[model samples]
Target: MDQVRVAVIGLGMGFSHARTLAAGRIAGGKLSAICDLNPAKQEEAKATLPSDVKIWNDADALIASGEIDAVIIATPHYAHPQVAIKCLSHGLHVLIEKPAGVYTKQVREMNLAAASSGKVFSIMYNQRCNPLYKKLRELIADGELGEIRRMNWIVTNWYRSQSYYDSGGWRATWGGEGGGVLINQSPHQLDLWQWTTGMMPKRIRAFCSFGKYRNIEVEDDVTAYAEYENGATAVFITTTGEAPGTNRYEVTGDRGKIVIEDGKLTFWRLRVPEPEFNQQYTGGFGEPECWKCDVPISGDNPQHSGIIQNFMDAIRQGTPLIAPGEEGIHGLTLSNAMHLSTWTDHWVDLPLDEDLYYELLQERIAQSSSQKTVREVGPVDMSKTFGTY
Candidate 1:
């Protein structure tokens, strides 16, 4: 196909995708259709998008109409894997939004379907498009940081008010969006945490505060400690309730340390590797000399549009995807482990027990008590929310 005709499945966050594709921003893709169950959203799309773009309220009908070559699933958290699986089974390429799914069991099923379908399956990990993170990943992969020793990310800048929660009934509830900050606000960072470092924790111990700052039933504050198999450890702290918050990620290794904060990348390079210096030092008080270097980052962060372009390239020109669908499970695995640790009040191991996780999640869903009146809030301007990582 010269142009991959794409349909976006939801109008909330997917509204931006629809506009970008309709505007011909991505060279190899065309916005053929848009789908949402909300008629108001459909009207909004019809009013803003081009007159020729097809609008449908039924996703199943649009999927079966053979009107599109690919689908971008931007529905709520639980429906991500469900819709992607259906789209893949129909022999269409699929691009799912982040956090994969609420749990790994469902995401595993979706990944298996993608594997068997032989279709281009990807996730909207837009942060991978950020040049700073790309450079960070390159450094870690090229061994510039040597063996990783520790990682700490304080990403509490995702502050949200009560109005934000009251804007949607399905948000911040176990029966709706599963978990809060980890699932919604911090998925990008969680994905970047493992993706940039090329490591997943062997075990995770987390503490989550449900509705501590809002009138919802899901976690809005979290602190998690993770241990890696290589003796490396990590600390992840986040909240949607803190103002004047901080966004900092620091990684320490045998060679030195790297810090990304305030939109700058700084590296402290040791004259010698710490292990080598320790072995050679004759004086007890002497330490390896360190030099501070400012790493220059250049390139525009295309964000969601960049992921869409990559998806199109992968489908039409056989280009590799920036964020493959299967790898999404790694980040979701970390999320599930955190939730499980909080639920069980114990340290959770990796390759999470999918069955037990599912069971516990169901219990939470049954016990959920979210009755906030949802206000009619228009589509959020997502441009303001990207690249803060």
Candidate 2:
């Protein structure tokens, strides 16, 4: 494929995006430009980026420059839609950071625009590249696990300290970062939860604990109950305050069960389908036997870089997307349902009420305590956070 020129906005997460898209790392990809509103960040990009990489303080001008064939938007939580819209308007392929937008309504606008742009629109849901998740989805889809009966995840290892929340005025505010962990740290899990299972909850009844673990107004602790259309149920539990937290994802089906944790996957396949065993087994006390095996996952997970490569390939060749930008709304629907359920203290239905969600979200913004428009922390080794992805 021919080389594709790319620019990244927001030096925050863009730091990783730019580095990953560097010319030598991926063939047919070029880190052509970097844009940020902060002049200091632009200067820093100049010092750190490749000499040939252009730096711009104005995103609009960079989008208009005709110098970049595509753009990676790593901007703040709320700016995703607008920035992506700008790129699509200019007929540029876009690879966007997750959470797609603060809400489904905004993401809908972006997705609609992408449809007209005829460009490769992808979201950075890089976890889809992980072999463990890949195998799990394969098993479920192949009916190796029969029909999914239950899904549960306790992804609390996304621990963040008070300083982490205080690092930016926009960190935890309802108006700023949307709704805390669900929007920021957990979009990956939320996306993976829905994607791996290939299921969408028809109903969500969640309990949110706001400021229970942090000093912010948004939720740091969330426990939700979800019921699928097929009568299967799921439980999602997460928090950002726990020390030495756990990351356990388990799925149970009629065939057997699968557990994924600590970078390992285990599958217990039933010798006979549960329905047959239950209906025909003559023994009163005997049940269908299960074969337990450790599902091996070989090769490193490509993660963010994988998504970028796929995006570039989609632009040049007709490759499939790891996570279509339009599908972002499914994960956001789960996140927004969790929040809206907690807000109304009732069940929230699928295809959430866009108007009601937007109205309630505004109430959250009205409660913000700080509105400073500056980043508090400096960039660190993002590899530590992304962790072998």
Per-residue lDDT for 151 in model 2? 94
| Cα lDDT, model 2, residue 122 | 94
Task: Give the per-residue lDDT of model 1 (tens digit) for 334-365.
Answer: 98999999999999998889899988888887
Residue-level lDDT tens digits of model 2 in 101-129: 88888888889999998999999999999
What lDDT does the true structure give each of the candidates?
A: 0.87, 0.85
* Ten-residue stretch with the least lDDT total in model 2: 380-389
Model 1 alpha-carbon drift over 4 Å, by segment: 370-389
In model 2, what is the error at residue 1, expressed in angstroms? 6.5
Worst 10 residues of 1 by lDDT: 380-389
Clashes of 1: 0
- Pick by lDDT: which candidate is best? 1
